[model samples]
Target: MVSITFHGGVGEVGGNRILIEDGDVKLWLDFGRSFTAERRFYAGWLQPRGHSQLMDLLEFDLIPPLRGLYAQHHLEGSPIPYEEAHYDAVFISHAHADHVDYVRFLDSSIPIYCGSGTKLFLEASETVGHMDYGEHLYKTFRTGDRIRIGDVEVEPIHVDHSIPAAYGFIIHTSSGSIVYTGDLRRHGPKGEMTEEFLEAAAEAEPEALIIEGTKIDEEEGGLSEGEVYEGVLRVLREAEGKPVFYTQNRRDTDRFRTFYEAAKASGRRLVITTWTAHLLSKLVKDEHLDLPDPMRDEDIAVYFRRKRSGKYREQDYYHWERPYLERKVTAEEIRRRPGEYLVCLELHHFPELIDIKPRGGHYIYSMSEHMEEEALEEELMRNWLSHFSLRLHQLHASGHMGRRELLEAVELINPRRVYPIHTEHPELYRRLLRGRRVENPERGRSYHL
Candidate 1:
């Protein structure tokens, strides 16, 4: 018997973790962390109340608490625990933060199986001083590459995602096969390659399809990153006032170009903070995407505004190197007039910047769903829109698959015992794939396979 358990991201889109066991052999699929949901419980010294569900997501294997591999001495607030349990191997699908952030949490000594690009990103994060993660124990493989683990043979099947070089894993045993779609979609520059991978898997015809439903509940299929570009434009075009594009910091260059085009069309200044500037710089370094018309320093504005209740505002324009980006401002910009700006919620200085009611300001919350969107009342999103009096909107697009496509994916893989890991709506997948024996392994519980 082969057993799979959901540690997190079941009935949720992120916190991707799963433990697979056969006989004495036990290993993991993806050990990931979900920041947005964790923030709900532990943000700003406020311990959230009424969390029956939060308790459930926290449970891991008979699951010991995330090990002390991550030294939490300097870590304050909720530093997610590194799951350092003993395992034969840990396989990674991609390098997206949600799927990969927990690397710092895990014991650094374990070997991780991933592609070149994935390892490149994991190393880059460590090299750039983003996190103090230990060196990775990585075995690189191309698509169709297979690695042997005791009695199990794990094959890598490439999948197309916004990010380059992602894949699904095909865990093979003599009795059956388990194909795990490690956080994938049907769209990308590599979509054709992904389709080929799916075709190959169809040929093999796995017994258990341990797939992901990152966006399985949606009516129309999830929007492509390109569609998100169109939606962001629509919000900016239809809005009555200066548009405020609110979103998370994913390394999405396509979305960045979309913002740039919208800013140019609206004839408003394209303003971004220091972080976005750095991200853009990195994009230029790697991929040759089209860039926006450069803005002068005087045209760019930083939102970390200062409170005028007897205070001197210090400017932090450190490492902001844009040859074309001209209009840059610090906390002092608060006294100036209103202009089209790009600012995150944290930078807006609370009600001082937001509560000053304005009719034309369009607020687009491109918030990606986690455990919170369904469980919590939109949390920070609701608070900011209500506080600012700005016309609230959702120009966001998901990074996951929709319901119909997810079913189609299950059909394509043709697994015997289907296990849904990446969806909070695992029951949805359970119902959709009727013929297969679907299992939602109870976290913290042990099963003999």
Candidate 2:
């Protein structure tokens, strides 16, 4: 008998944690944080204490209370007694915080399996952002690679997503084959990759299909990556003589490429932060990914903020950020010639707007809209942009599949039993996928096949 447990990603988007057990072979699919829970318990500066993090989270039932799963350090002083790793391994689908953030709490003894690009992403995050995913025995695999753990043979297949090196899994268990789609979309630049994955999944004819339904709501019609590029180009053309400031998920390399190309076409240098430049530099090494090297890319220039000491000293910045110092462009330079640069500004860097005051610039928001109307950050962002007299242009491509596309994919795969995860509207699937074995899995419930 093969059993599957849904720990998270129920009645919400993101925070996916699934455990598969084939007899004694127990392992996890993805260990992600619940974004919905995180927002409720902690906000802004108020966060869980570092020393009593596990206890705090457990109090609210944020994390699963599984013994022998968490690291000893994290379980220190907690009520739950710590034990050695009981699981075989952890298979990470991608490096997104929602999909892999809670890996820090896992036991270091359990080996981690992920794509080569995913490993690089984690390394870059640790190097630049000081965010560590904990030290685990990592085993990197590429597309078409099959991993064996006891009786289970897991195949990692590449899939198109918001981030590079995202994958879906084909797990061969004693009962039957199980397919797990780890946050995939068929609308991005790499849509073909997702198609290939679906074709393979269809051929497998798995007994169980574990998929993500991030955009399975009333929301319809999404722009493809190409469309997004075109939209961005149009926006840049309109703001010909004014500065164009854009905000997007820094990890979305495809969007980065879109902005870079748009900037180049408009005869403007894409000014990125030192941290972004470092990430790009690290990503460029992956020959499979066609990321431009920050060091050699003429159209790219790094931005440096005036830190403490009142001087742009090399010691002020981290080692990863120091490399881009030579190619740094100051706020004064951007202020003097705003039209010649397309500045990438994050919400935290809104203070820089005061120094680089532009008369009437354009702010391109190339990201998803907040699900909540009363999102504090979005309200605050608008106030800042309004004060700067910046026109906001919302142009973005979603990282998830639309309703029609998702339904089509589900029909094509046609698994024996369908279980939707990472979605707020799982009922949509039940309503649309009539006559199919669709199961709306509840969190912490175990379903056997």
Candidate 3:
């Protein structure tokens, strides 16, 4: 028998941990953190201890307390004895924090599998101090590759999402084929990839389907990637030669491309942060992404803030960051030629506004609205904009399928049993996918397939 257990992602938006056990062979789909649960106990600087991260999280049941799953270092002083990994492998769907952050606590011996592009994102993020996933024997695969472990043969297929190189999986277990849709969209720039995945999934005739319902509760229609580009282009045109600032997820290459093209069309050079410049440099290796090389692209400029000595010294920045300094654009340059640049700025970098001093510029919020925990941050952001006399433009395109498209995809896949995770309202799937076995999974409960 093939049994699956839900350790997290039960009636929640993230923290997706699904364990599949077939005979003696066990594997994990995704080992993401529970943002909602973490926020409940910790906030701001009051985070888990660095040395005892696993223990602190397990104290509140934030992570699953499974034997032989965590690294020995993380279990240094814990009551649980450390041992070699019992699981065969872990397959990451994408590099999103909600889907891949907690891998740091896992035993190093357990091999982790992900798309080659996802590995690039992870390495870039680690280099920039954004995340620390610790050490692991990583193995990368692409769309057509098939990975075999014990009795399971997993096939990963590319899917259209906000981030590049995202994928869904078709797991061939002893019982039957199980399909897992790791957060996908049908209207993004790579929509055809999603169509291909759906076609293949339907062809497999899987026994179980695990899907994400991030946007299922909302009634609003999702904007296609083209619509987003057009909306942003209109904003750039309306800016009237003022330095328009925008911010989005750092890993979202599609959105970055949208902004890059829009800026080019408007005859403005796109200015990105040093971290973005480094990420782009790494992503250029993937030809399919078609991103601009920040170092060589004349239309792109890297923004560097004065740090440490306050003289923009070479030693102040990391070695990886120093390479992009040749294309650096300081605040004063942007202040003098505001009209010539479309700058990428986030809330943390709002301090630069005092230096740039754009009295009446427009700020484009290219990402989604703030989560409930980010209420105070939003208010602080407004204060900064108000003080700078800047106008806020909330123009964004979601990275998930909307209500109609999500339902349609589910019907088209036509799996025997539909299990919905990664949503607040899992019950909605029962009503939406009528005449289908929609399982509202309970946390920590095992279901036989």
Candidate 4:
């Protein structure tokens, strides 16, 4: 008998931790942070204790209380005694925080498998961001590779998403084939990759399908990547010799490319943060992505903010960021010639507006509409824009499929049973996928096949 349990991503947008057990083999799909659940108890500075994260998370029932699943160091002072690795391996679907952040707690002995590109993203995050995925034995796989562990043979195929190197999985077990769609869309630059994944999944004639429904209840603008580029280019042209500021998910390289190409077309250099510059430098190694080398890209410039010294000294920045000092652009330079660059500004960096002092500028919100947790931040952002007299624009292409496309893909795959995860409206799948075996899985409950 084969069994599957949903530890997270039950009825939430993120925090995906699914456990699969087949005979003597045990593995997890994705170990992600419970963003929605965590927000309920903790916000901002109030967070779980770093050293006792497992204990803190367990105290509020934020994560699963599996005894042998976590690292011994994290479980040292916890009531649940530490144990050796009990799982065979963990398969990560993508590089998104919602899908991969909690891997830090996993036992180091348990091998972690992900796409080669996915590994690159993880490495970049560790270097530039405050994230630490811990010291797990990592094994990278590509699209066509078949990885075998114990009795199961897992085939990973690439899918199109907001971030590059996203994938879905096909697990061949004794019972049957199980297909897992690890967040995908057919409206981005690599829509064909999604088609290829779906076609291959259908050919396998899987017994079960685990899919994401992030945009199931929400109405999308139905904009494509090309459309996003067009909209942004129009905004750039309308800037009228003023600096154009934009905000997007720093990890969304597709959106970055959209801005990069649009800036190039408008005869403006795209200014990015050192964080993004470092990420791009690491990602450039993958020739398949065809991303421009930030160090050598003539159209790209790194923006340096006033840091600790406020003097723009070499010692003020981290070693990873120091390499880009030669390519740095200052606020004064942007203030003098605003029209020459398209500046990347996150919400937290709004204070820099006091320096750039662009009386009338265009600010593009190239991201999803604010979520419940971001309501306060949105208000503050609006206040900043109002104070700066900046015009706001919304131009974005979603990384997830809209309702019609999602339904169409489900029907095309035609799996024996459907389990919906990473969604607030799992019941909607039942209403839409009528006459089908749709299972609205409850967290911590095991379903046997």
Candidate 5:
């Protein structure tokens, strides 16, 4: 008998952990943290203690208690005894925190598999933020690579998403094929990649389709990445003699490219922080991706803030940040020529506005609108922008498929049974895809195939 367990990503948006067991073969899909659960217990400075680690999280039932699945050190003081890895391997879908953050607690003996670009993302995150994902035997795979683990053979197909190197999986089991869509979007810049994945999934004729429904409730309209680019250009053109500041997910290279192009078209250099410059530098190594080299690109400039001792010193910043110091421009320089540059500033760095002080600039909010839980932060951000007399332009393309597109994709794939995860409105699928077998998975439940 073949069984699938929904450990996470049920009745929520993220924290996907799916266990597929066929006879003696067992493996997990994605081990991610639930944003909803994490916010409920921990907030701001009050976080889970490192020494107590698993104990703190397990106490709140934040992480599922799976024997022999976690590292011995993390399992210490817990009720479950330490044992050898009971699972075969972990197949990561991407490098998003909501999908791969929980991998830090897994046993190092179990191998972790992901795309080659995903490996680079993890390495960069560890180097800059000191966020350790523990020690694990890692294996990298690309599109069309079929990996065999015991009785199951897994094939990863590339999918378009907010982040690069996102993928969907096709698992060939003894019973039938199981398809897992790992945070895909069909309206982004690389929508063709998602089309390729859909074709492959349709050909496989999956018995079970595990898909994400992040925007399943929102029907009809949504902006594409191309539309977002046009919006950025419009904002830049209207800024006139004032500076333009934009904020987006730092990991979103596509959005960076959009702003880069828009800045160039507007005859302005795009100024980014040292951290973003470092990330772009690392990402440029991938020959397939067309990212501008921060070290060589004249259109790109690094923003260096006054560090320790109130001076711009190389030693003040981290080792990774020092590389971009040579191309640094201080706040005074930006203040002198505000209209000549488009600055990329994060919410935390809003204090820098006191120094750069533009008369009346434009602030492009190139990210998702604030969710209900983040209302206070949104209000504070608006207050800051208002204080500076900056015109706020909210232009963003969602990183998920719209309701109609998602329904169409499901119909094309034509899976025998559809289980919607990573969504709050799984029930919408029942109404949307009438006559199809739509299952709303419950957490910690085992469903046999």
Candidate 6:
């Protein structure tokens, strides 16, 4: 018997995760944080939102502290997994914290299957000094590579999302095939790779298909990520002075290029911080999406800023350091004539500049809700962006698959019993896959097939 259970990421965006089982062998798709919803719940430690609306924005299955998945550590001798859940593998689609951050809590022996880029970013050796992880066996496979663990033979078909080396997997079991789209977007520098992977999945004709529904609203429209880049470029051009683009990390190299070209043409500096520089270096692996170490000229001054404290020591710089060519600046630099500089910063950095400018510049809120407080405690959020005054535009694009692409992928794969695992809009997927046998399984409630 084969079974698939939706552990989280249903009826909500982000937090795409599930557990798929073929008899005794169990494997998890992705275990991401509920992010926005989780912060509001764990307010003190997380976002610290003050009585903000509940952030049950995304749903997750496992209980807190992650003991359920680890099969160890019980609270006051309560009911635990009778069988002690042991997964053969945990496959992560990309680097987005939602899918990868929770892995540290799981059992270390479970082998992790992911594309090369995903592994590169997770492992500390690739980025500056290595970060932390829970206990999990790390294994890497390329786009077309396959690996076996017990009865399951998994093939990673490369797909594009917001990040590099994102993928959907083809899991072969005794019963049939299960194609799980970890997370994906239709347009990027190497969009053809994602299309090819989807095309082949259609050819393989899997028994079941699981996909993401990040952009389910009717308003998302038909614009591809590439199309969004074009539109966002138009927005950048409207800026009369140095254009500062606050965005998520290096995944959107294509979009960055558009900004870079615009900045270069306008004879402005294309400044990037040390952290973003490191991320940029890893993404250049795809030949078609290459961005050389940014060279800052007199007109193109790339200002680099280090935190006042020494959280990231200078000695920690890695192999990519040569390319960054970074020069550190102080908070005072940002307050100087806002039009004279184009500075990029994430939400946390906003507080540092609060003393310098009190709202004249613009803020483009990029990235997912997973990173920020449900609402930045007014003082912290306002203080950060206060120094700079001006307009705020949310022209950022998505890194997850939209409703249409998910539908096309499902139709192409032609699964026998399609399960919409990670979506707030499983209904949309349901509407699109009218003729297919679809099941929306609940967490912990196992149904045998």
- Compute each candidate's TM-score over C-alphas: 0.71, 0.97, 0.97, 0.98, 0.98, 0.78
By summed lDDT, the worst window of 10 consecutive residues in model 4 runs over 369-378
Candidate 1 per-residue lDDT over residues 45-80, each given as its tens digit: 454333222233333221225444333321223335
lDDT of 5 by residue, 1-449 (tens): 77889998997888899999998999999998887777889877788997877888888888889887999999889988999989999999998887898999999999999988888899888988678999999999999899999989999999999889899999999999999999988888899999999999999999999999988999943888889999999988899779899988878888999999999999999999877887888888888777999999999999988879678887898888888888998889989999899999988899999999877899998887522223238788999999999999988888899889899989999999999999988999988899999989989998877
TM-score of 3: 0.97
Residue-level lDDT of model 2, residues 1-449, one tens digit each, is 89999999998888899999999999999998887877888866778897787788888888899998999999988888999889999999998888888898899999999998999899998987778788899999998888999999999999999899999999999998999999888888998999999999999899999988988884553888899899888888988889889988878899999999999999999999887898888888899998999988899999999888658899988777888888889889999999999999987888999889988989988887633212347789999989989999888888888788888888898899999989888888899899999999999999999
Clashes of 1: 19
Cα lDDT listed for each candidate: 0.59, 0.88, 0.88, 0.90, 0.89, 0.61
Cα deviation at 122, candidate 3, in Å, is: 0.9
RMSD, candidate 2, Å: 1.7
What is candidate 6's lDDT per residue for 128-149, written digit by digit as tens? 6444555566787776677776
TM-score quality measure for candidate 2? 0.97
Range of the 10 consecutive residues with the lowest summed lDDT in candidate 3: 368-377
Candidate 1 global CA lDDT score: 0.59
Residue 350 lDDT in candidate 1: 42
**Candidate 3: segments with Cα more than 4 A from true spot:** 370-376
The C-alpha RMSD in Å for every predicted model, in order, reads 6.3, 1.7, 1.4, 1.3, 1.4, 5.6
